[model samples]
Every structure is written in structure tokens, then in C-alpha cells.
Target: MLIMKPRILNGMMICGTESEMRYCDIGELHKDFHLGTNTTIDFIMDQYDSGFLLELCRRTAQIVYKDIYQQLQQGNSAVLIEHLQYYLDREGGVFDIKTVQDEISVNVSKCPMLSHITSNGETLSPNIGDFLSDFYGSWGENTPFIISVDYTYPEESYCIYIRRYYAS
Candidate 1:
């Protein structure tokens, strides 16, 4: 008898040689921090201020994009969005970016982090989504054009990110 592995096996994709790092490692850290798992995810994000979380996102993005915030300051919304999409894809994210004048959106069918964590038989702390939300939100706030990362419903795995740029 042979048992074949499914492509979408739970948590199997994480912590493997094929991928850069085991996303489940973060979950383990959260556990070691004495935080409960498999629940409490929503409470965390709701408690944190969106602006503050977004600020963190901005700082992190600066490092990843190599100070491309300079271009963002020049009101290059499309360029920033394009760069972000590339980075996300390279990092194992599955999504497509759609851009309209002064507005861009990411239609994500599979969120790599969440999928891996759930696959590994663990629950995300509330902080996880909060981190992601603020990060995306912060990305919107970076450009000279005022941008907003809009979260789509049902706000879970198959979520949508809409970033709107109001060019000043």
C-alpha cells in the first residue's frame, strides 16, 4: 500500500528545503511567548491601532524595497504596486494584482503564511492578521498619493487587498 502526498498537504510546505523558511516557526515563537494558539487572532488586530501597524509595515517595506519609498514620494503608485507584487510572489504568495487609475488591488486566492500555519495543525494568534493588515495598510500610506489597503470579506484565507491611491 502506498500513501501519496497531496500538493496541498497541511503544513507540509512549511519548514522544508524547497522553501526559504518554515512559516510555522513564527507560530512556534508565538507559542513560546506564552500566548495561546488556535484562537485569539481577532482580538489582537482589533486592539492595535491601524496607523501604528501600518507604520511598521512602512519601515519593513523600506528595507525590502531598498528605499523605493523615494519613488513612492514622487507619486509612482503603479511602480510601487508592481514592485510589491513581485516581492510577494517571490516570497511564495499566490495572487494577482489589478491596477486601475489611482487604484490597485490584489486578488489573493492563497495566503502562504496562513495556509502553512493552518496546515500545520495550529491556529493563528490574533496578531498574525493584524501584522499583515497593517503591513499592507502601511504600504498604502507610503506613497505621495494617499493610498488605502482595503480588506475584502470574508477577510480570511481568500481575501482581497485593495490599495487606492489618491494622487495629490
Candidate 2:
């Protein structure tokens, strides 16, 4: 007889072998956090104005992208793109990335976060675009790149364009 114990290794949860093995990542944690954060923002919006929510979103973006900002400062742009792809994949996002000249475009057909929240009978913040804009904008600040996000909320899709910039 063999007894298998569940353990966490390299950010994945390992329980058994083959089919019994389960993979886990921070995506789920992020989903929960996003839900809570959105809910809090919604509650606050009732008492405050849109500026407060935008500022909160901007601050959240700053905190979340702080490490990525450091990496960009260290000249690790490839790693940043790779990390973004990996993150979207892990979160079950439907997206495609294309590179043209000095620009890279990421087209997200389906947003995993929105899907998760809606599936749970929750509504996403109407100002979600502001958060995304501030998030990528903050990450690109003082870096050698320009990041922009274009959203089509009715279809729940968006495209992020990252262009490298060089000082002349």
C-alpha cells in the first residue's frame, strides 16, 4: 500500500501521479482578489465620485506592476512579454500575439477575469478600461517602451500594443 500526500512545489499543487495530479497557480487567487477589489470599488463608488475609483485603480496598477517596472529598468523586455503570455495562458485567456517591426500586439478575444466574475453572478466595474489603461501606462512610464490598451467591451475583447522606443 502507498499513501500519497499533497504538496506544493514550484507554485503548483501536486497531489498524485498522472491523471490524479492537479495544477494550481495564482490565477485563482487573483480572480478572488479581483472580485473583492471590484466589489469594494463598487461600494465606494456609491458614496464617492469616479475620480476616486480611477485613482484607486491607478494605485493598484502601480503596486501590481512594481516588479515588472524593475525588470524593465534592468533591460529585460523579453522576459516581460514572456511573462505576460504565460500569465494569460495560465489564466485561461483567449489571446493572440503578433509582432510587426518594433511593435508587438496582443489581441485578447476572451478575458478570463471577466468570464470568471460573470460566471459567478457578479458584474465587472464599468470603469474597467481605466484600470487597464493606468496599469499598462504606469508600467511603461520611464521605460523604453510605449504600452497602450484598446478595449471593445461589448464584445469583451481588447488589444494591447507595445512599441519599443529609442531616444534619438
Candidate 3:
């Protein structure tokens, strides 16, 4: 049995064995997904308050953190920074990660979601910062690490500093 891997090539998602390959137009899918996500976010903001959105982001972060934690426990061998780098690279985000001593800094020059949202002529929610704060805050819960984020929505740029905490 041949193992099939999915890859992106020339704006197409290619998958399946070499004998028979399947191709999907990544451009169409990307546009549709971004539009749907932007619309959903707008609808959610219109229907609920910012606090509600923050809570949702927090919960999502907790879930993701738990999964990463579990993977680490199973001897995945990848560090948190590596996981973050993988996510950003896969999501089409332009970012740089640097580690110094016990601290890691992630600088995102182009936030894919935010860029897509703004490109669609949609206004960002005023509570975007609060949402991000809650998300990263919750993500570090129950861990010996913490993350701080500073972002400019208009420029779609952000800097995240991740530091290890020690209980002395």
C-alpha cells in the first residue's frame, strides 16, 4: 500500500498516489474559506458582545493547548515554538521566530486571517485585541510558560513574546 501525502503546488492542492493523483484548485478554496470565515466572524460580532467572543477564543485556545500538551506527553519531541512555527507556515502567515535564552519572540509581519478579512473590505472588530489577549492567556494556562502579544491591526503585524516562568 502506498502512502499518499497532500501538498500544495502552483496554487493547487495535490494528493493521492503517483499512479493516480487528484488536484484541487487552492485559490478557489482559499477564497471561499476566507470569505466564509470573515462573514461568520462579522455575524458573531453582530449577534454577541465582545466578551462572548473573547470567551470563545479563550476556550478554543485551551482546547488547542490541551492537544499540544497531550502530544508532548506522548513524546512528540517538538517544542512549543516549533509547533507555532509549523502552524504559521501552514497558514500562509509571514513570520519570524527567534529564541534567546528562555524566551522566544514571534514576529508576524503578515497575519493571514487579518489580511484576508481586511482585503475583503470588512472592518475589524474593535475587540480584536481583547480576543487575542484572552486566547494567548488561556493557552498558557496550567503551563510554566506565558505569552504576551502586541499587534497593529491596520498593519496586520504582531509580536508575541513567550517566556518561561519559574516559581521561586
Q: Which prediction has the highest TM-score against the true structure? A: 2
Number of clashes found in candidate 3: 0
Residues 112-134, model 3: lDDT tens digits: 77777788787765556665566
Q: Indicate whether candidate 1 or candidate 2 has the larger TM-score.
A: 2
Alpha carbon deviation, residue 4, candidate 1 (Å): 34
lDDT of candidate 3 vs native? 0.63
Instruction: Estimate the TM-score for candidate 2.
Output: 0.70
Model 1 agreement with the true structure over 91-113: per-residue lDDT tens digits = 46788777676456676666655
Runs in model 3 deviating more than 4 A are: 1-46, 69-79
lDDT of each: 0.50, 0.67, 0.63
Which should have the higher TM-score, number 2 or number 3? 2
Number of the predicted model whose lDDT against the real structure is largest:
2
For each candidate, give its TM-score against the true structure: 0.53, 0.70, 0.68
Candidate 2: where are CA atoms >4 Å away? 1-30, 44-64
**What's the C-alpha lDDT at position 150 in model 3?**
90
- Candidate 1 regions off by >4 Å? 1-55, 63-66, 152-168
How much lDDT does candidate 1 score? 0.50
TM-score of 3: 0.68
